[model samples]
Target: MARYAEVVRWPLVEALAAYEHRLREHARRQYELDFIAWCILAQSGATKRKRPPALPTILKEE
Candidate 1:
């Protein structure tokens, strides 16, 4: 629970940071219990996935 702070807190931080090509990549990692719980929660969701509103364009159009 305590260990998932970074992943949950900065879920979209990396994506936003990547546009500048300055994002650092971390090695693949996962927490066992958290992963299992996430899987269960994800499965419990209804069949339809809700689409979020479009994000503002980060980079300028060419």
Candidate 2:
């Protein structure tokens, strides 16, 4: 995962973090895996935000 982290552009960190937060909030049991699934859903245009936004990315660390 560290290798993948290196490839993440700094600007997109917020989008990723936002997805993780949503996962934690709504799918607390398996937030990690759910976050990935949410990304897939959003990317496939199955979610409200066809393209995730960065505003929600300003999440406080847990």
Candidate 3:
């Protein structure tokens, strides 16, 4: 849990610092996992794999 502080903090701090130091157009997001999404991911860490992948590889049968 403590290890994930960077994952949650980096993007927000990065964005805020970018805006503070640079223009909005120049400030690109470094990560997709913002604070809210990170919270969700942390809460639901164990995602259930009830169904097979939507695009499973096809195989030739003998």
All candidates: TM-score: 0.25, 0.30, 0.22
Write the number of the candidate with greater lDDT, choosing between 1 and 3: 3
Candidate with best TM-score: 2
Tens digits of per-residue lDDT for model 2, 14-50: 8677767776576444545556777988777785645
Model 2 residue runs over 4 Å out of place are 1-29, 48-62
Ten-residue region with minimum lDDT total, candidate 2: 52-61
Model 1 lDDT tens row, 1-62: 78567546765867566534432222112233444555666678843434322322332221
- Write the candidate numbers in order of decreasing TM-score: 2, 1, 3
* lDDT score of residue 60 within candidate 3: 14
Q: What is the Cα root-mean-square deviation between model 2 and the actual structure?
A: 13.7
Better of 2 and 3 by lDDT: 2
- lDDT score, candidate 3, position 7: 49
Give the alpha-carbon lDDT of every model.
0.43, 0.59, 0.44
